[model samples]
Target chain A: MHGETAPPPTGPFADPALYTEITQFYAWHMALMDEGEPDAWADAYTEDAVFEEPGRTNVLRGREAIRASITKRTAELAAAGTVMRHWMSNLAVTPQPDGTLRATYYSLAMRAPRGERPDIFAHVVCRDALVREGERWLIRHRHVGIDALEK
Target chain B: MHGETAPPPTGPFADPALYTEITQFYAWHMALMDEGEPDAWADAYTEDAVFEEPGRTNVLRGREAIRASITKRTAELAAAGTVMRHWMSNLAVTPQPDGTLRATYYSLAMRAPRGERPDIFAHVVCRDALVREGERWLIRHRHVGIDALEK
Candidate 1:
């Protein structure tokens, strides 16, 4: 199951390997973010990546803009020194026959800034992604929704 | 890759394959719900599954109770003929050496009942799952937080 294409998978997806690859892609990306480099998190996406969060009319676009946004978040986290851990589940990876992959998953980020107990900061939106560019899959677009963002 | 557990490669996880299996498990489970089978959706979880919606203090537990709650929801959907689709992404799956999988993913579910413009229904809190059982993974526990829920 390494690099070689498998048989045609049934039920809306062709490649099962795509699912494994995209899932691994996310695991690696998030791990980088958790390592405290938000810039690396933002850089994991395409240069023209469009990032959106809930309750904000503005959609941050491009690598620089995305980096700026992440930098601001990192700054905030640095000030608070909160240990935030993101939890994700229920990922839906749908594969297109053309070898491209589209996936969605559910996530929760538990933010425990300082000495406070960890609280559920955001119920988030897991957006669809296009995975290509040889072996490495980068997120092309992302839109995050806040299910509940109350402090 | 269909059952090939070759020592479980390491990537911030002791059993990465469990993560993938659990992800697909939830995917297949939710897909059953989207296909209008809420009974199966409720049945997919364990007897002690937990479900919580933000802003409401009530928590749903147990298989029968969960089924009842889902049945109620299904009844509403049946009456409304609402078509719901959950998009999930950003899955980070970390497997403990013990084989229990801790995973997270972000999700967005849009509901379009009776042809109205699809509205973002829930920005959700997705938590890590404990996947047990030999090849198939089940959501042993699930905690949901609503960052935003459709009014």
Candidate 2:
């Protein structure tokens, strides 16, 4: 029931403040992950969130599970001396009838061997269901679809 | 100057009508391409639009060139007896300061030989700058990034 603000008369189509919040959500999420703060990154999700990668049959439900999965991945990457950066773009947010926001964006995962030129390892399109908790938008469900399969 | 409609007091954050229009834009674009209506698909772009697929060095500017490129690709697919379907998801649309909209989505292209189980051929994240031409939203610039490289 946070819909008291009147929309602008012209110019941008969406509420500028709402848009800024969503964009910042992604930016902060990425920064947390890249900085090796798995727990902090996972805090962006709701307690009962569902995380899935359809192409890989990876599904982790609940915030604790999600955090564990990311932590394990981070450890593996660190052990291999590979640094990964995820670049997300082309984000679209939609308001659903059920009082939730659906967000979609494309992600490019670039990986390097410590000090090498990063090569694109994965290109993914992500769909997220987000809910507002207090003043923050936390993810409730996230689905990632990978573009191509390797040999 | 198209922003006169007031947003709903509750439910989704985006203007429902604008969200519908943007989603339908993608639906129509995909349908036109899948149905072999290249001209109609190309019409979705502005006269001076830029279409780029950096992974393939494919940059087609202008509506006519964009049309030609799609037409050629359609013919080649037809000749090879491949029926391709492009599935787009995770679509996010943002209103820019320049009175244009930026749309980002994920696309998964599936291809099959007439009667085979379609296999994923490509995954892409697309970022589009769209302009409103009368009542329709048209692409002003499009960038497609592929997910993976081939061996």
By TM-score, who's the top model here?
Answer: 2
- lDDT tens string, model 1, B15-60? 4444455557657767667667766676556667776655854777
Native contact fraction per model: 0.16, 0.00
lDDT (10s digit) by residue, model 2, range A1-151:
2355866543433455565457556755774665577877777788899999986866898989998898998888878876665667787777777868888888876554442333557889999999986655889999999895443
- Once fitted onto the true fold, the runs of candidate 1 whose alpha carbons sit more than 4 angstroms away are A1-16, B1-23, B31-69, B74-151
Chain B TM, cand. 2: 0.87
Which pairs in model 2 have colliding backbones? A90-B104, A91-B92, A92-B92, A92-B93, A93-B92, A104-B90, A147-B123
Q: How high a TM-score does candidate 1 get?
A: 0.55
Please tell me what DockQ candidate 2 reaches. 0.02
The list of candidate 2 runs beyond 4 A from truth reads A1-41, A46-131, A139-151, B1-13, B149-151
Which candidate number would show the highest lDDT if scored against the true structure? 2
Q: How well does each candidate superpose onto the true structure, as a TM-score?
A: 0.55, 0.59
